[model samples]
Each structure stands twice: as structure tokens, then as C-alpha cells.
Target: MMPNTTTLLISAGLLLARPISTLAQTTDPNVDNADTPFIQNIRPDRPGQTVTTNMLHPGQVQLETGILRFDPTDASWGTRRTLSSALLRVGFFNHIELRASQGYLHPLPGTSVFNEANPTVGPAGFTPLTVGAKFLASTNQDARSQVVLLTEMTLRTGDASFLNKAYEPAIRLLVSQQLGARYGLEANVGFRQRGFQAADTKLGQYLGTLALNGPLGGNFGFFTEAYTTWQRSTRFLPGLTSGLYWRPLPGLRLDVTAGQQFGNLGTGFTLGGGLSVRLPK
Candidate 1:
């Protein structure tokens, strides 16, 4: 029997590395501090459209839950509310993790042009379940840079009122860079299929986001972001968002966020709050 390359690499890593805690450490400036306790330093992906590149260590699990509300300046769009938005993450390897997300979309009231545009919406329904995996593509300790690749699929497993019969796929490239010792920068680029009805033509849009985060003294931190999306046939949609997060515990984070969309047809704003917790392995 011959030893494989993977086996050799694993053996080399085991031999070169010193024994350390099973919990993972994070590069996030807000969560990584001397005063912070050691509870698998949690890096949450919530309160914003931009997802972080931090990966949980093997055997770790994290849960993020939140609620969001959106109100468009135009009445025809009606109001949108997400009663429950949740994401579950489980680390299976040093550089790989599994993720799943679900949310409930409350129906829009009254007759509106929005109903015609989205025939599958306007009733209380479960959002399509999204399952994905994130892989740490590369990292540089000296440069303080990290790159992550995320691939996901929105399965046709929700209520028909939502997007229950569509197979939508998405991929994102996430990048993080540490700025000095107190701030970090994150950027994401991706594309995904978007449409409500399964039978309707779905259009894919390219999205990009840039965010900056830093500590606000003590257990508090702040983040601000700008994001935009574009389709070949449609105009670009741009938005800005900012949020504050409180980490009372090393394994928990609470955040409140607000953002507004800029569009010629109509403008909308969103407000949301969420909490993230890293559980015991």
C-alpha cells in the first residue's frame, strides 16, 4: 500500500503543529481581544448583506437568528416583513463548514403591482431553504488576509406561496483584510438567480459589497457597508447599511442594523435586529 498525498500532508500538519485548544480563534477585531473570554470566538454573519469570511473550527456550531422589516416609499410595493430569519452553521473540518438558512415571509396586504410582479408571494409563507458550504480558500497570517469561497443552493422545498419550485444556485467570493489592530475590512462578490414564481423567468444579478468593522471600546463594535447589484438588462441597485453590535459574552453577539435602497422607481428602507451564539462543542 502506498501513502497518498493527503495522508502525507495531514501527517505533516499534525507533526508540525503544537497542541492547542479545540476551539477556534477569529481574526475579527471586535471579537478578538485580550479581555474576551475563550468560548470559540464567535464571528456572526448577520445584520448585513455581506457575509464574513471567518470559519468556525471543527466540532463547533453557531446559530444566528433575527427579524427584519422593510417599507418602500411606493405603496404599490406594500410592506415586507420577515418574522423569523435564521442561519445554522456547523464546522466539519479546519477549513470547511456547512450552513443552512431559513426565513418566514409575511404576506403583503391589499392589491398592488407587487402582487402581479411576484405571483408566488403576497401570502404568509416559508422562504426557500438555502443550504451551502463555505471553504477557506487561502489565508496569510503575516499579511492578515483571508479568502473564502461559498456555494449555495436555494432548494424548492418551501411553501408554494414563496419559491417552492425553483432550483437557484449561488456562489460568492469572500475576502477579509485586517486593518491595523482595531479594524477589519471585508468584501464579497457573487451572483444568484432571483424570482418569486417557479415558472417565471429568473434573472441572475451580480452583487458586490464592501464593509468595514471595528471595536467601539469595551464589548461594543460597529460596522458600515455599501452594496450594489446589477443585471445586464436592468439598472443597478445600490444601498448603504450600518450597524452596532454588542458582545456581552465571548460566544454571543447582538446587533441592530438599518439600511436604505436607492432606486429611481421607488426607494425602500430596512431595519433589523439579531443575535448570534456559538454553542458548546
Candidate 2:
């Protein structure tokens, strides 16, 4: 049997060689600080569009639950509210982990475009379930810089009007770099397979995001980000997001996030809050 090179890199970072006594004896008292307690070297995705290259250690588990609201100035559907969305991640190996996410989505009481005329349709709307595998491709010895890849599949098991009944798959690349004592940069590029209903066309889009994060004295952290979606035939849909993370406990992180879209048509804004809870590794 052969060990995976990427896996080796991740282990080297998480399970560093520094002895406990040595780290404790260092002159810099905040050498071990991180943006969030749930993650080792970076903040989670709750409050920003940026995805971290860091992953949970083996036997570690985390749950991210949040509420999100989107108000589209021109959307015929009115407003959309996600009462709750949950992402569960469990580390199965040194550099490999699995994630499952599905958030509940529904329109404000009177603002639904879904057709209730068809009794066969079970529910009004819900986000499709998605599952993915995250693998660490590379990481520095100190865990200050890292690269990771994620492959995901979204099942078309939601309401008929809301889902295209297509098994959409996606791949994302995440990179992280530490610029200074308090600044960290993250970049992401991704591709997804998408198909629509009624429309005879199949579609695909490229997703990209860049973000910067830093600590804000006290148990808090801040981040700003820009992200976009584009295809060859369509104009880019861009958005800017910013948020803050607070660690009230050793294993829990809380966050609030907001984003505004910049496009000629159907522009909108979003606001949300979430919490991450990490279990013993």
C-alpha cells in the first residue's frame, strides 16, 4: 500500500512536530491563535464566501447551522428565507473528510412562486441535498499555507419546480496563505454542471472567490470577500460579502454575514448568521 502525498502534507500540518512544552515556552503568546476555534488555521464558510483549505482532524466532527435571508428587488418570487441550513463534516482520515449539507428554503408566507395547483408535488421548496469529499492536496509544515480540493454532488431530490432532477456535480479548489501575523488570504475556483427545467439548454458556470481575514483583538475575527459566477454566454454575476466571527467558547464559534449583489438585473442582498460547534477529535 502507498500513502497519498496530499494526505501526508495535511498530517504534517495538523499533527505538527512541535512539542507541547516547546509551543508553551515560545515568547509569542499568541502563536497558537486561529480565526475560529472550530478550525485549526482558518475560519469556516459561515460568514463569508471564502472556503478554507483546512479540514477537521481525524475523529473530529463539526456542525454548522445557520439562518439566511435573501431579498431580491426584482425577483418575482418576492423574498426567500432559509430557516435553517446544516452542514455536517466528519474527518475519516488524516487528509480526507466527508460533508453533507441541506438547508430548508421557503418563501415568505405570501411570496411564493411555486405552483400549489399540483397535488403530486410534495412540498413548496427546499434546497437539494449535497454531499462532498474534501481532500488536502498540500500544506506547509507550519500549516500557514495550504491547498485543498473538494468534489461534490447535489442530488435532485427536492420539489419538482425547484429542482431540475439532474445530479449536478462540482469541483472546487481552495488555497490559503498567511500574509502577516494577523492577515490571511484565501482563493477559490470551481466548476459546476447545471441543467434547467423547461428550458432546452444545459448550462455550466465557473465560480470564483477571493477573501482576506484577520483577527480583531479579543475573541473576534473579521473577513471581507468578493465572489462571482460566470459562463461563456452570460455576463458575470458578482457579489461582495463581509462578516465577523466570535468565539465565546473553546469549541463554539458564532458569526454574522451579509452580502450584496452587483448586476444590472435582479440584484439583491443577503444577511445571515450561524454557529459552528466542533466535537472532540
Q: Per-residue lDDT for 1-281 in model 1, tens only? A: 25698899889888766443223334344444433332234678887889988777778899999988876444533556556789999988667989999988665655332244666435456777999999888743123577899999988777665423677788999998767665779999998874545433346878899999888888898989999987768888899999999988878899999998789632468889999998763
Model 1 TM-score (2 dp): 0.75
- For each candidate, give its TM-score against the true structure: 0.75, 0.76
Off by over 4 Å in 1: 1-40, 72-77, 108-121, 139-143, 194-202, 265-267
The candidate scoring highest on lDDT is 1
Model 2 TM-score, 2 decimals: 0.76
Tens-digit per-residue lDDT, 1-281, candidate 2: 24688788878877766765577666443355444232343346566667777677788888888887875443444545454788898878768979998877665574434665643322346678899988888743235577889999999776565734777788999998776655778999998875534332346778899998877977798878999987767889899999888877656888888889887642467888998888873
Model 2 alpha-carbon drift over 4 Å, by segment: 1-42, 72-74, 111-113, 116-123, 139-142, 195-202, 265-267
Predicted candidate 1, C-alpha RMSD:
10.5
